[model samples]
Target: MDITIEHLARARLITTEDREIPVSATLRYTTCDPLAVYVDFPAEAALDGEEVTWTFARSLLDQGLRAPAGHGDVQIWPCGRTRTVVEFHSPYGLALLQFQASALRRFLVCTYGVVGSGQEDMAAVVERGLSALFGGV
Candidate 1:
Protein backbone atom coordinates (compact mmCIF):
# COMPACT_ATOMS: atom_id res chain seq x y z
CA MET A 1 0.00 0.00 0.00
CA ASP A 2 1.17 3.52 -0.78
CA ILE A 3 1.21 5.77 2.24
CA THR A 4 1.31 9.54 2.04
CA ILE A 5 2.45 11.92 4.73
CA GLU A 6 1.98 15.65 4.76
CA HIS A 7 3.05 18.40 7.09
CA LEU A 8 2.34 22.11 7.07
CA ALA A 9 5.39 24.17 7.87
CA ARG A 10 5.88 27.89 8.27
CA ALA A 11 8.91 29.21 6.42
CA ARG A 12 10.52 32.57 5.90
CA LEU A 13 11.91 33.79 2.63
CA ILE A 14 15.35 35.31 2.95
CA THR A 15 15.73 38.00 0.37
CA THR A 16 18.92 39.42 -1.06
CA GLU A 17 18.81 42.29 1.42
CA ASP A 18 18.47 39.65 4.15
CA ARG A 19 14.85 40.47 4.83
CA GLU A 20 12.54 37.65 5.90
CA ILE A 21 9.15 37.08 4.24
CA PRO A 22 6.75 34.63 5.78
CA VAL A 23 5.29 31.75 3.77
CA SER A 24 3.66 28.43 4.42
CA ALA A 25 4.45 25.23 2.51
CA THR A 26 3.01 21.81 2.36
CA LEU A 27 5.73 19.21 2.87
CA ARG A 28 4.79 15.92 1.29
CA TYR A 29 6.23 12.40 1.27
CA THR A 30 4.87 9.16 -0.02
CA THR A 31 5.84 5.56 -0.47
CA CYS A 32 4.75 5.96 -4.06
CA ASP A 33 7.97 7.89 -4.61
CA PRO A 34 10.03 7.28 -1.51
CA LEU A 35 13.29 8.92 -2.52
CA ALA A 36 11.86 12.38 -3.07
CA VAL A 37 10.27 15.07 -0.99
CA TYR A 38 8.01 17.76 -2.41
CA VAL A 39 7.52 21.31 -1.24
CA ASP A 40 4.40 22.98 -2.54
CA PHE A 41 4.39 26.77 -2.58
CA PRO A 42 1.14 28.63 -3.05
CA ALA A 43 0.33 30.66 -6.17
CA GLU A 44 0.87 33.98 -4.39
CA ALA A 45 4.46 33.02 -3.82
CA ALA A 46 5.19 32.27 -7.44
CA LEU A 47 6.10 34.82 -10.11
CA ASP A 48 3.65 33.28 -12.58
CA GLY A 49 0.92 33.35 -9.93
CA GLU A 50 0.62 29.55 -10.07
CA GLU A 51 1.35 27.04 -7.38
CA VAL A 52 4.90 25.72 -7.52
CA THR A 53 6.14 22.35 -6.49
CA TRP A 54 9.83 21.74 -5.90
CA THR A 55 11.01 18.16 -5.75
CA PHE A 56 14.32 17.06 -4.31
CA ALA A 57 15.96 14.10 -2.65
CA ARG A 58 14.55 13.19 0.71
CA SER A 59 18.05 12.40 1.95
CA LEU A 60 19.24 15.89 1.08
CA LEU A 61 16.79 17.51 3.45
CA ASP A 62 17.74 15.00 6.12
CA GLN A 63 21.48 15.60 5.78
CA GLY A 64 20.98 19.36 5.58
CA LEU A 65 19.59 19.49 9.08
CA ARG A 66 23.05 18.66 10.33
CA ALA A 67 25.24 20.20 7.66
CA PRO A 68 25.10 21.69 4.17
CA ALA A 69 23.74 19.44 1.43
CA GLY A 70 22.75 19.57 -2.25
CA HIS A 71 24.00 21.60 -5.18
CA GLY A 72 22.82 23.00 -8.49
CA ASP A 73 19.11 23.79 -8.58
CA VAL A 74 18.58 23.14 -4.86
CA GLN A 75 20.85 23.73 -1.88
CA ILE A 76 20.00 23.15 1.74
CA TRP A 77 21.99 24.07 4.81
CA PRO A 78 21.65 24.68 8.49
CA CYS A 79 21.13 28.31 9.42
CA GLY A 80 22.36 28.37 13.03
CA ARG A 81 20.76 26.07 15.58
CA THR A 82 17.03 26.41 15.07
CA ARG A 83 16.63 27.17 11.38
CA THR A 84 17.40 25.54 8.04
CA VAL A 85 17.75 27.21 4.67
CA VAL A 86 16.56 25.73 1.39
CA GLU A 87 17.63 27.56 -1.76
CA PHE A 88 16.04 27.10 -5.18
CA HIS A 89 17.52 28.17 -8.50
CA SER A 90 15.81 28.53 -11.86
CA PRO A 91 15.72 30.54 -15.06
CA TYR A 92 13.43 33.04 -13.38
CA GLY A 93 15.88 33.66 -10.51
CA LEU A 94 16.48 32.38 -6.99
CA ALA A 95 14.53 31.68 -3.86
CA LEU A 96 16.09 31.32 -0.44
CA LEU A 97 13.78 30.03 2.24
CA GLN A 98 14.40 29.63 5.95
CA PHE A 99 12.38 27.11 7.84
CA GLN A 100 12.15 26.14 11.49
CA ALA A 101 14.34 23.14 12.19
CA SER A 102 11.80 21.62 14.53
CA ALA A 103 9.08 21.62 11.90
CA LEU A 104 11.37 19.91 9.40
CA ARG A 105 12.43 17.35 11.93
CA ARG A 106 8.83 16.64 12.81
CA PHE A 107 7.98 16.16 9.18
CA LEU A 108 10.90 13.82 8.61
CA VAL A 109 9.91 11.79 11.59
CA CYS A 110 6.49 11.29 10.08
CA THR A 111 8.06 10.18 6.79
CA TYR A 112 10.36 7.75 8.52
CA GLY A 113 7.37 6.18 10.18
CA VAL A 114 5.83 5.62 6.77
CA VAL A 115 8.82 4.48 4.72
CA GLY A 116 11.72 4.21 7.18
CA SER A 117 14.61 5.70 5.25
CA GLY A 118 16.90 3.18 3.52
CA GLN A 119 14.14 0.63 3.69
CA GLU A 120 12.29 1.60 0.55
CA ASP A 121 11.55 -1.11 -1.96
CA MET A 122 13.98 -0.06 -4.67
CA ALA A 123 12.92 -2.78 -7.09
CA ALA A 124 9.46 -1.28 -7.11
CA VAL A 125 10.73 2.27 -7.09
CA VAL A 126 12.99 1.67 -10.08
CA GLU A 127 10.32 -0.16 -11.98
CA ARG A 128 7.93 2.68 -11.41
CA GLY A 129 10.56 5.20 -12.44
CA LEU A 130 11.13 3.36 -15.70
CA SER A 131 7.43 3.11 -16.34
CA ALA A 132 6.94 6.77 -15.77
CA LEU A 133 9.85 7.49 -18.05
CA PHE A 134 8.74 5.41 -21.10
CA GLY A 135 5.05 5.39 -20.31
CA GLY A 136 4.92 9.12 -20.91
CA VAL A 137 6.48 8.58 -24.33
Candidate 2:
Protein backbone atom coordinates (compact mmCIF):
# COMPACT_ATOMS: atom_id res chain seq x y z
CA MET A 1 0.00 0.00 0.00
CA ASP A 2 1.10 3.57 -0.78
CA ILE A 3 -0.09 6.99 0.36
CA THR A 4 0.10 10.33 -1.43
CA ILE A 5 -1.41 13.81 -1.12
CA GLU A 6 -3.02 15.42 -4.14
CA HIS A 7 -4.97 18.58 -4.83
CA LEU A 8 -8.68 18.06 -5.20
CA ALA A 9 -11.19 20.73 -6.19
CA ARG A 10 -10.77 22.53 -2.88
CA ALA A 11 -9.32 19.89 -0.56
CA ARG A 12 -6.42 17.45 -0.37
CA LEU A 13 -7.14 13.80 -1.08
CA ILE A 14 -5.31 11.23 1.09
CA THR A 15 -5.41 7.72 -0.24
CA THR A 16 -3.99 4.21 0.09
CA GLU A 17 -4.16 0.94 -1.89
CA ASP A 18 -4.61 2.88 -5.14
CA ARG A 19 -7.27 5.01 -3.45
CA GLU A 20 -9.28 2.09 -2.12
CA ILE A 21 -9.21 3.51 1.40
CA PRO A 22 -9.12 7.31 1.52
CA VAL A 23 -7.72 7.16 5.08
CA SER A 24 -7.54 10.81 6.03
CA ALA A 25 -7.50 14.15 4.19
CA THR A 26 -6.73 17.84 4.62
CA LEU A 27 -8.41 20.77 2.90
CA ARG A 28 -7.09 24.31 2.56
CA TYR A 29 -9.55 26.74 4.04
CA THR A 30 -7.99 30.24 4.02
CA THR A 31 -5.06 29.91 1.62
CA CYS A 32 -2.69 29.61 4.55
CA ASP A 33 -4.26 26.83 6.61
CA PRO A 34 -6.09 23.58 6.10
CA LEU A 35 -9.78 23.35 6.92
CA ALA A 36 -9.75 19.81 8.29
CA VAL A 37 -8.14 16.34 8.41
CA TYR A 38 -10.09 13.10 8.03
CA VAL A 39 -9.00 9.55 8.89
CA ASP A 40 -10.45 5.96 8.78
CA PHE A 41 -8.79 2.58 9.31
CA PRO A 42 -9.37 -0.97 10.54
CA ALA A 43 -9.56 -2.28 14.14
CA GLU A 44 -6.16 -3.99 14.16
CA ALA A 45 -4.74 -1.14 12.16
CA ALA A 46 -6.16 1.34 14.64
CA LEU A 47 -4.78 -0.56 17.64
CA ASP A 48 -1.36 -0.85 16.06
CA GLY A 49 -0.91 2.92 16.09
CA GLU A 50 -1.42 3.18 19.82
CA GLU A 51 2.06 1.83 20.61
CA VAL A 52 5.45 1.11 19.08
CA THR A 53 5.07 -2.58 19.86
CA TRP A 54 3.48 -2.95 16.42
CA THR A 55 4.34 -0.92 13.34
CA PHE A 56 1.81 -2.59 11.10
CA ALA A 57 -0.50 0.40 11.10
CA ARG A 58 1.96 3.27 10.71
CA SER A 59 4.55 1.16 8.97
CA LEU A 60 6.82 2.53 6.25
CA LEU A 61 4.83 0.44 3.81
CA ASP A 62 2.07 3.03 3.75
CA GLN A 63 4.20 6.09 4.23
CA GLY A 64 3.37 8.47 7.13
CA LEU A 65 -0.36 8.21 6.76
CA ARG A 66 -0.69 6.11 9.93
CA ALA A 67 0.53 6.85 13.44
CA PRO A 68 2.68 4.65 15.66
CA ALA A 69 1.14 4.35 19.12
CA GLY A 70 2.77 6.32 21.93
CA HIS A 71 1.82 8.53 24.86
CA GLY A 72 2.68 11.75 23.00
CA ASP A 73 2.99 10.75 19.40
CA VAL A 74 2.55 14.00 17.45
CA GLN A 75 0.65 12.15 14.76
CA ILE A 76 -2.15 11.38 17.21
CA TRP A 77 -2.97 14.19 19.58
CA PRO A 78 -5.97 14.86 21.78
CA CYS A 79 -7.67 17.74 20.03
CA GLY A 80 -9.37 19.64 22.82
CA ARG A 81 -12.93 18.28 22.56
CA THR A 82 -13.17 16.51 19.26
CA ARG A 83 -15.10 13.25 19.32
CA THR A 84 -13.18 10.27 17.96
CA VAL A 85 -15.54 7.55 16.83
CA VAL A 86 -14.00 4.10 16.73
CA GLU A 87 -15.91 1.42 14.87
CA PHE A 88 -14.82 -1.97 16.11
CA HIS A 89 -14.32 -5.06 13.98
CA SER A 90 -13.40 -8.59 14.93
CA PRO A 91 -10.16 -8.41 12.98
CA TYR A 92 -9.84 -4.60 12.84
CA GLY A 93 -11.59 -1.31 13.63
CA LEU A 94 -12.83 1.92 12.06
CA ALA A 95 -12.28 5.40 13.43
CA LEU A 96 -13.52 8.84 12.57
CA LEU A 97 -11.56 11.90 13.67
CA GLN A 98 -14.11 14.69 13.90
CA PHE A 99 -12.81 18.10 14.79
CA GLN A 100 -13.18 21.83 14.11
CA ALA A 101 -12.23 23.34 10.75
CA SER A 102 -10.45 26.28 12.34
CA ALA A 103 -8.09 23.91 14.11
CA LEU A 104 -6.24 23.00 10.94
CA ARG A 105 -2.69 24.39 10.97
CA ARG A 106 0.27 24.25 8.59
CA PHE A 107 1.79 21.25 10.29
CA LEU A 108 0.28 17.75 10.05
CA VAL A 109 -1.58 17.60 13.36
CA CYS A 110 -4.22 15.07 12.40
CA THR A 111 -3.97 11.42 13.49
CA TYR A 112 -4.79 8.30 11.45
CA GLY A 113 -7.52 5.81 12.48
CA VAL A 114 -8.90 2.48 11.32
CA VAL A 115 -11.69 2.18 8.74
CA GLY A 116 -14.51 -0.25 9.49
CA SER A 117 -17.38 -1.65 7.45
CA GLY A 118 -18.33 1.34 5.33
CA GLN A 119 -14.90 2.58 4.37
CA GLU A 120 -15.96 3.29 0.81
CA ASP A 121 -18.02 6.15 2.16
CA MET A 122 -15.22 7.59 4.29
CA ALA A 123 -14.69 10.68 2.11
CA ALA A 124 -18.36 11.55 2.20
CA VAL A 125 -18.58 10.82 5.92
CA VAL A 126 -15.56 13.01 6.60
CA GLU A 127 -16.91 15.78 4.38
CA ARG A 128 -20.37 15.69 5.89
CA GLY A 129 -19.10 15.18 9.42
CA LEU A 130 -16.80 18.18 9.08
CA SER A 131 -19.56 20.26 7.55
CA ALA A 132 -21.90 19.32 10.36
CA LEU A 133 -19.18 19.73 12.96
CA PHE A 134 -18.33 23.23 11.72
CA GLY A 135 -21.82 24.16 10.56
CA GLY A 136 -21.45 24.70 6.81
CA VAL A 137 -17.82 24.91 5.57
Candidate 3:
Protein backbone atom coordinates (compact mmCIF):
# COMPACT_ATOMS: atom_id res chain seq x y z
CA MET A 1 0.00 0.00 0.00
CA ASP A 2 1.06 3.54 -0.63
CA ILE A 3 1.98 5.66 2.39
CA THR A 4 2.18 9.38 2.92
CA ILE A 5 3.89 11.77 5.31
CA GLU A 6 2.15 15.05 5.92
CA HIS A 7 3.48 17.87 8.03
CA LEU A 8 2.35 21.36 8.84
CA ALA A 9 5.25 23.74 9.36
CA ARG A 10 5.25 27.37 10.33
CA ALA A 11 7.30 29.64 8.08
CA ARG A 12 8.39 33.24 7.95
CA LEU A 13 7.81 34.86 4.58
CA ILE A 14 10.62 37.22 3.71
CA THR A 15 9.41 40.39 2.18
CA THR A 16 11.33 42.83 0.00
CA GLU A 17 11.49 45.42 2.77
CA ASP A 18 12.96 42.83 5.15
CA ARG A 19 9.76 42.19 7.04
CA GLU A 20 8.75 38.68 8.08
CA ILE A 21 5.17 37.48 7.65
CA PRO A 22 4.25 34.36 9.51
CA VAL A 23 2.63 31.73 7.31
CA SER A 24 1.65 28.11 7.54
CA ALA A 25 2.77 25.62 4.89
CA THR A 26 2.00 21.99 4.30
CA LEU A 27 4.75 19.52 3.48
CA ARG A 28 3.73 16.29 1.83
CA TYR A 29 5.49 13.12 0.69
CA THR A 30 3.84 10.04 -0.71
CA THR A 31 4.82 6.77 -2.25
CA CYS A 32 2.51 7.62 -5.12
CA ASP A 33 4.91 10.38 -6.08
CA PRO A 34 8.07 8.79 -4.83
CA LEU A 35 10.55 11.04 -6.60
CA ALA A 36 9.04 14.35 -5.55
CA VAL A 37 8.08 16.35 -2.49
CA TYR A 38 5.26 18.83 -2.38
CA VAL A 39 4.84 22.03 -0.39
CA ASP A 40 1.48 23.73 -0.31
CA PHE A 41 0.82 27.36 0.57
CA PRO A 42 -2.49 28.85 1.52
CA ALA A 43 -4.37 31.41 -0.49
CA GLU A 44 -3.42 34.18 1.90
CA ALA A 45 0.18 33.69 0.97
CA ALA A 46 -0.42 33.81 -2.77
CA LEU A 47 -0.26 36.81 -5.03
CA ASP A 48 -3.29 35.61 -7.01
CA GLY A 49 -5.46 34.80 -4.01
CA GLU A 50 -5.36 31.07 -4.60
CA GLU A 51 -3.64 28.21 -2.91
CA VAL A 52 -0.40 27.10 -4.56
CA THR A 53 1.68 23.98 -4.38
CA TRP A 54 5.22 23.48 -5.66
CA THR A 55 6.67 20.11 -6.52
CA PHE A 56 10.39 19.44 -6.64
CA ALA A 57 12.84 16.57 -6.42
CA ARG A 58 12.87 14.78 -3.09
CA SER A 59 16.64 14.61 -3.29
CA LEU A 60 16.74 18.39 -3.42
CA LEU A 61 15.20 18.63 0.01
CA ASP A 62 17.69 16.15 1.41
CA GLN A 63 20.68 17.87 -0.20
CA GLY A 64 19.43 21.29 0.81
CA LEU A 65 19.51 20.32 4.46
CA ARG A 66 23.26 20.12 4.14
CA ALA A 67 23.85 22.82 1.58
CA PRO A 68 22.06 24.75 -1.17
CA ALA A 69 20.14 22.68 -3.75
CA GLY A 70 17.81 23.04 -6.70
CA HIS A 71 17.62 25.57 -9.50
CA GLY A 72 15.02 27.19 -11.76
CA ASP A 73 11.68 27.91 -10.11
CA VAL A 74 12.47 26.31 -6.75
CA GLN A 75 15.55 26.57 -4.61
CA ILE A 76 16.31 25.43 -1.07
CA TRP A 77 19.21 26.13 1.25
CA PRO A 78 20.15 26.06 4.87
CA CYS A 79 19.58 29.21 6.85
CA GLY A 80 21.82 29.71 9.84
CA ARG A 81 21.91 26.84 12.30
CA THR A 82 18.25 26.40 13.11
CA ARG A 83 16.37 27.32 9.98
CA THR A 84 16.01 26.55 6.26
CA VAL A 85 14.98 28.75 3.40
CA VAL A 86 12.94 27.57 0.40
CA GLU A 87 12.44 30.03 -2.42
CA PHE A 88 9.81 29.76 -5.17
CA HIS A 89 9.78 31.84 -8.33
CA SER A 90 6.83 32.56 -10.61
CA PRO A 91 5.38 34.97 -13.08
CA TYR A 92 3.74 36.82 -10.23
CA GLY A 93 6.92 37.06 -8.17
CA LEU A 94 9.03 35.12 -5.71
CA ALA A 95 8.14 33.66 -2.33
CA LEU A 96 10.95 33.12 0.13
CA LEU A 97 10.05 31.38 3.37
CA GLN A 98 12.14 30.28 6.31
CA PHE A 99 11.26 27.12 8.19
CA GLN A 100 12.57 25.50 11.31
CA ALA A 101 15.44 23.21 10.41
CA SER A 102 14.41 20.69 13.02
CA ALA A 103 10.91 20.47 11.64
CA LEU A 104 12.21 19.84 8.15
CA ARG A 105 14.66 17.25 9.36
CA ARG A 106 11.88 15.44 11.17
CA PHE A 107 9.75 15.45 8.06
CA LEU A 108 12.58 14.13 5.95
CA VAL A 109 13.17 11.35 8.39
CA CYS A 110 9.53 10.40 8.31
CA THR A 111 9.68 10.13 4.53
CA TYR A 112 12.64 7.80 4.77
CA GLY A 113 10.72 5.67 7.18
CA VAL A 114 8.22 5.02 4.44
CA VAL A 115 10.58 4.80 1.50
CA GLY A 116 14.28 4.40 1.96
CA SER A 117 16.67 6.25 -0.33
CA GLY A 118 17.35 4.50 -3.66
CA GLN A 119 14.79 1.91 -2.70
CA GLU A 120 11.92 3.23 -4.77
CA ASP A 121 10.20 0.65 -6.98
CA MET A 122 10.49 2.52 -10.23
CA ALA A 123 9.13 -0.44 -12.14
CA ALA A 124 5.89 -0.06 -10.22
CA VAL A 125 5.84 3.65 -10.86
CA VAL A 126 6.40 3.11 -14.58
CA GLU A 127 3.82 0.36 -14.66
CA ARG A 128 1.29 2.73 -13.18
CA GLY A 129 2.23 5.38 -15.68
CA LEU A 130 1.89 3.00 -18.60
CA SER A 131 -1.37 1.73 -17.20
CA ALA A 132 -2.70 5.25 -17.18
CA LEU A 133 -1.34 5.96 -20.61
CA PHE A 134 -2.85 2.82 -22.05
CA GLY A 135 -5.76 2.44 -19.68
CA GLY A 136 -4.26 -0.79 -18.37
CA VAL A 137 -4.80 -2.24 -21.84
Q: Compose the digit string of candidate 2's lDDT tens values, residues 44-78.
A: 33346642111222222122223222232123333
Residue pairs clashing, model 3 = none
lDDT of 1 by residue, 95-120 (tens): 99999999999999899988888898
Order the candidates by lDDT, highest first. 1, 3, 2
Model 1 backbone overlap count: 0
Mark the regions of model 1 whose C-alpha exceeds 4 Å error after superposition.
none
**Candidate 2: 10-residue stretch with minimal lDDT:** 52-61
Structural similarity to truth (TM-score) of each candidate: 0.96, 0.17, 0.92
Q: Candidate 1 or 3, higher TM-score?
A: 1
Judged by TM-score, which candidate is best? Answer: 1
Please, what is the whole-model Cα lDDT of each candidate in the order they appear? Answer: 0.93, 0.30, 0.92
Please, what's the RMSD in Å of model 3?
1.8
The 10 consecutive residues of candidate 1 with the worst lDDT sum are: 128-137
